[model samples]
Target: MAQHAAVDDLVKLLTKANYDLTLVQHRLDKEFQQIYPHNANPLKLVSRIKKIQEDLSSLKEECRELLAAKQDLIDKARTTLVGNRSLLKRMQASSGLPLISDSDDLAYTNLNQIINEWTVQVRPKTGDGKHDSDSEDINQLLFSAIVQNS
Candidate 1:
């Protein structure tokens, strides 16, 4: 359970960090636009744009590492659970315990259900095409505008 909690926390932190980085980049782009206007020095603008790109790239790499760490934790937990369950089954068979219906079957089913629910809850949703699509479009527009201005 603690391992699970730790993985969940890490995922949350990574998600928040990604969001914050995006917001910061957006704000920086806006500021750059305001400061540079149309007639600003090309060399300065180019340098500033390169710096922002580098920062964004570094943030993305960090996000990817965090995601990979979270996945590794989850995989370790799953492997441990599977091994434990196999051992339990072997012990039960050796002890001549009343062979209840296959416990492993039930455990796997429950684990699958829990994982499905967790995935649904943690994933970001893309709403119906009308309203939510506008945000994505706006982001693209902003990105292009920044590149063009730079």
Candidate 2:
């Protein structure tokens, strides 16, 4: 039937678009990596939002290492961390289609913000320069965000 042929054409068109979209995503990732080499590119961060959320949820807030740190750092981290839950939900709503789209500026901004805050040094605490072992988890998380070739 003509309708079946039309549907086949639509699927083929969408497949081509999706392929083109991936190439664009990689190009964007390379550009962003230059500016944010230490942090995960925002697009990759958004793509991995679920994995990050799971890692965040499993953190032991009561770890002695975290408790001794300045309160402000903890406070700000808490505020930023809460927003990721909603981001994960938004990604879920998109289901099979790529989450990256022209209309996702807010989500992209939020994800970039999260990546910024998690970068190695949030602030300079006035104390011995040594850092706690538990806090290193966050450092590793950020480092892992970088693309392997980057």
| Best prediction by TM-score | 1
User: Candidate 2: lDDT of 106?
Assistant: 76
Worst 10 residues of 2 by lDDT: 140-149
Candidate 2 residue-wise lDDT, 84-122, digit = tens: 655765876777544545347675567557645643342
Task: Kindly state the number of residue pairs that clash in model 2.
Answer: 0
Report lDDT (CA) for all predictions: 0.64, 0.59
Work out how many backbone clashes candidate 1 has: 0
| Candidate 1 per-residue lDDT over residues 78-136, each given as its tens digit | 78987887787788889987544545488777876775553443333323323322323
Could you tell me every candidate's TM-score relative to the true structure?
0.38, 0.33
Candidate 1 error regions (>4 Å): 1-52, 99-110, 114-150
lDDT of 2 at 121: 46
Candidate 2, position 105, lDDT = 60
